[model samples]
Target: MIGQFPPIILASKSPRRQELLKLMGIDFTVVLKEVDESYPSGLNPTEIAVYIAEKKAKAFDESIRNEIVITADTIVSLDGQILGKPETADHAFEMLSALSGRRHDVITGVSLLKGHKLYSFYELSEVFFKPLSAEEINYYIAACQPMDKAGAYGIQEWIGMIAVEKIIGSYSNIVGLPTHRLYRELCRITAQ
Candidate 1:
């Protein structure tokens, strides 16, 4: 699987994304390129995710050789509002409080860039959380330090273990990247 596709350059610093790519048995190089994640005001959840992903991919110019550049963005949308990474502990607590006993959508958009050509797509997963107490939210926030994660929580962390009630769609999407869809898309692109 590693050698099936052209060399891949993953343009992200996310450990979760790195782990997912490794789990897929794909050989790729990690290259971090910071890009503004701001999106148009009217874009929906999935669109915002894909837009940022493609924006990150475009950071690399046409000089790239045979390497395929991969970039991804994940966003948590609750009632059509995006819950981004919390900047402060208070904010994290607020995000967690809003998510209590509610179903939210987690969408991740991925972009694959080869030289000047680009491909992009997105995946969505619905996550339901059991009603959480203020104590539980604060405790989880203190323990997990979810400031770096969207929706102020990691689905693979302690909060997810006790708080997540159920999920529909790809679990990996909620984790960060949609590996199954990514693999299939990579296969399709490499086949050509």
Candidate 2:
């Protein structure tokens, strides 16, 4: 039986995350807060993602109680450099263009905060892209709002079908959350 607790809270504005949670039958609320994503320069991709996720969770006012809080941060890394959200259409174009005919890593950091207890984990997925044309990149950038997405692309979008040649890990990780890891972690939190 499900234990009686406050409704789970998701600290994100991503519709994909929200929908994915819904698909898992987890009831949650979208409570987004602005947090500075800047992290130490030396941290690896997973560390950076985890650090930012925890930072976002910590940003929530301390007044909240009981309910579990889930927060996440995702980053796309190529050759050890993190490719974050695009600053402009051209930036998105550049990111995608570079990714063409190459494989990149998408890392997502997930944090589950229940009261004072905090658990954090990260998942990385390798995404391969077929060599794409400049016009194709431009079309994707213009058609999809890449500014809000990491790696300047969305895995569930049209780009995923044509541009993504293969995925070596959890596809959901590229979407923002690793559902398999998240489900297990959330269950552990509930079991505790």
Best by lDDT: 1
lDDT of 1: 0.92
Worst 10 residues of 2 by lDDT: 1-10
Give the per-residue lDDT of model 2 (tens digit) for 127-181: 9999999989888887887799998999999899898889999998899889989
Off by over 4 Å in 2: 2-6
Specify the highest-TM-score model's number. Answer: 1
Question: Ten consecutive residues with minimal summed lDDT in candidate 1?
Answer: 1-10
Candidate 2 deviation (Cα RMSD) = 1.5
TM-score of 2: 0.95
Clashes per model (N, Cα, C within 3 A)? 0, 0
Clashing pairs in 1: none
